[model samples]
Target: MNRLNLFAPDVRENPYPFYATLRRESPVCQVDPNGMWVVTRYDDIVAALKNTQVFSSAGLRVASEPPHLQRHNPLSDSLILADPPRHSQLRNLIGRAFTATTVASLETRMRSTAARLADEMLQRRVVDFVPDFAHRAQANALVQLLGLDPSLQPNFQRWTTDILSVAAISPDDERRMQDVRRSIDEMEQYMNDLLASRRRQPGDDLVSGLLRSRVNDCALTDEDLMGFLFLLFVAGLETAVTLMTHMALILARLPGWMDRLRKELDLIPHFIEEVLRFEPPVHATMRLTLADTELSGVRLPAHAVVALLVGSALRDEAKFQDPDLFEPARRAQASLAFGHGAHACIGAFLARAQARVVLEELLSRCRRVELRAERLDWNVSLNTRCPLALPIEVIPA
Candidate 1:
């Protein structure tokens, strides 16, 4: 597939068909512009994700770091790019703040925020789900969880957009690159200030918990803290935001399911899980070969870029029966939405909690959701899939 470019608009619009084709024709084939290998089969992707020794997470950093934006991208230094033993140390230290009880404790407050947002949206009757509900819900949840100033909530969307843009920049987009650089500086400074403030007078927040957390009797250095906070802000907010938006889209298109969910509230969790498996927020992830490795009998040279098509893997016919159908209660297998192994999202619990709360609130407030737009406008990105805007009319309960 020499002409294939995942970032191209056509492919990004609906990649599943392409993924299905690739999985059938060539499960491991090199794609265009950059001869990065794309692995589509479920077992192969799982094996590659688990075998981190051969497939390094540093590939994420490599993929994001273009020549002009090398040291400036905060994600380059974040935990997502690190491999063990450094990855282990960071995960062990930071994982303390995300315990089940702690994440659960934040739900009441999250639901409260969601309830307010839902009421406002339902009162409006017609509104864009992305900004009106999903983004706001996720932003407030992040603020509550991290004890960030509520005033700063407005900047979360911009920061997340600019920072993640680094991963999908076009060669000639100097203007976009400049924006990303500035956003990186601003976000890094904010994180540093927050870290210092937490150190002086700790609060009942994730930042303070991290300040107090220790690994092998050593406190996290300034760089580590800042990098982690950057990662946390983007991953924590974006993943859940996308998930909520996807749920809204589903509701808009599948109105009957909304009624089902409202009646069988218990099925909400299953619905979310199915969404994770079917319409995952992230479709793929990058990994670099640390040494020469072979995947599905295809030889890969050292330092080759590999895209683990987790979205495709989730729909692999081998792993999931009738993978194309959205089955909420089919007994889900392991999902790579938050990923697998050491590099799996540490904030997965918090993301899931926020989605559940927002979804439940929306269902309670609205009897049905109908899209105002004629078609979906997907956000342009390399790996993630979500609508840029979802204008919907909510019928109040």
Candidate 2:
């Protein structure tokens, strides 16, 4: 059987075509030598995500941690990989400090940071959207959210990129594993110091708020705080960076959409929604089968790793008509861009708000954004889809 390998160069570059083929030919097919399955159909993914008992979230750790690291990975202990009661406890306690209101409160800061970055990029006339604007703006937002010193902003992108790359690391790649380990160590030290500083002098940031939160008369342990901070620094920042970069890429590729959005600024939110569906930053999520289960009549053994292809599901013909076309106003069914069920992205609101602010800032200052005639280089990761760099030429308004 020709199993699909998601890490293959060609597939990593553009997995949608392969996803469509899998959904049509074999929706529940093995994608790895370890008997890991890939679920492509929208309905199948939805069912699996909702049935967390059978489809355990422990598979997220399996997909993220290299074999050498195993349970030692800090990210493995985060809220994203927890199940049931434990996940509930963490989410509820953390949710109080990460509400939509908290995100709303950051709008002024977000706008200022975005406007400054946009202005700097526009001054250059030609800029790489990923590093020049998206990375810097998202990093600044994260630092502000965490209430950390502004001096710490420079390493946020590198640390996040290294940490997130572990999701697709080859078990045999000793060099890459070492680099990831070094990054993890450094980030942990930084987080520990930051946490200590917060304890000494709490501020009005999310980290300080998280430090003060408690559940069942017990404050969050140092380990718990470390894991959560790691999650926020890596997943929160990386996802937002990917979202804004992709938005810029889309606008540069389709000048007409940019023109439309620039004129009808009110439609930017809808455009953001469609962008989440059309080209979601996260391409897939992982789950484990806790017990023997059948999906679409195919049997999956207990503990089998399953990859829910969120990218494919968004374009499934059964779910959305003309699934290939970009329609900003299509609100038939909610997209799984931020995921579904219990493990939906806790930072979705923050990410959406940040993207909107940055895009609006750029559009309001620029007449046109166009991509140069250069081949796009996508980041080599199994779970995320985004350009390594998006070089664009901007015409100032």
| Regions more than 4 Å wrong, model 2 | 32-35, 59-67, 332-334
Clash counts for the predictions, in order: 0, 0
In the range 1-397, model 2's lDDT, one tens digit per residue, is 5887777777877778888898889998898646578898999999998998998886567656767654367777788888988888888888877788888988999999988987887889898888888888888888778876789778787788778878667778878878888888888888899999988999888988988887778677787788889998899888898899888888887778878987787788899998898888788888888899998889999888788889999989898899888888785444599889898889999999998998888888988888985687777665788888888988897
For model 2, state the Cα shift of residue 72 in Å.
3.0
State residue 303's C-alpha deviation in candidate 2, in Å. Answer: 1.7
TM value for model 2: 0.94
lDDT of every model, 2 decimals:
0.83, 0.84
Tens-digit lDDT track of model 1 for 1-397? 4547777777777788888998888899898647789899988988998898899986567666888774656677778999888888888888776577778888899999999988998788999999998888888878887888899888889999988877678878888888888888888887778888888999888889888888679777777877788888998878888888888888887788988887788888899888898888777888889899887888989988888888899889988899988878786844588898777888888878888888888777888899998877788665688988899998998
TM-score of the candidate numbered 1?
A: 0.95
Q: Model 2 — which ten-residue stretch has the worst lDDT?
A: 63-72
Clashing pairs in 1: none
Query: Which residue runs of candidate 1 sit more than 4 Å off their true CA positions?
Result: 1-3, 170-172
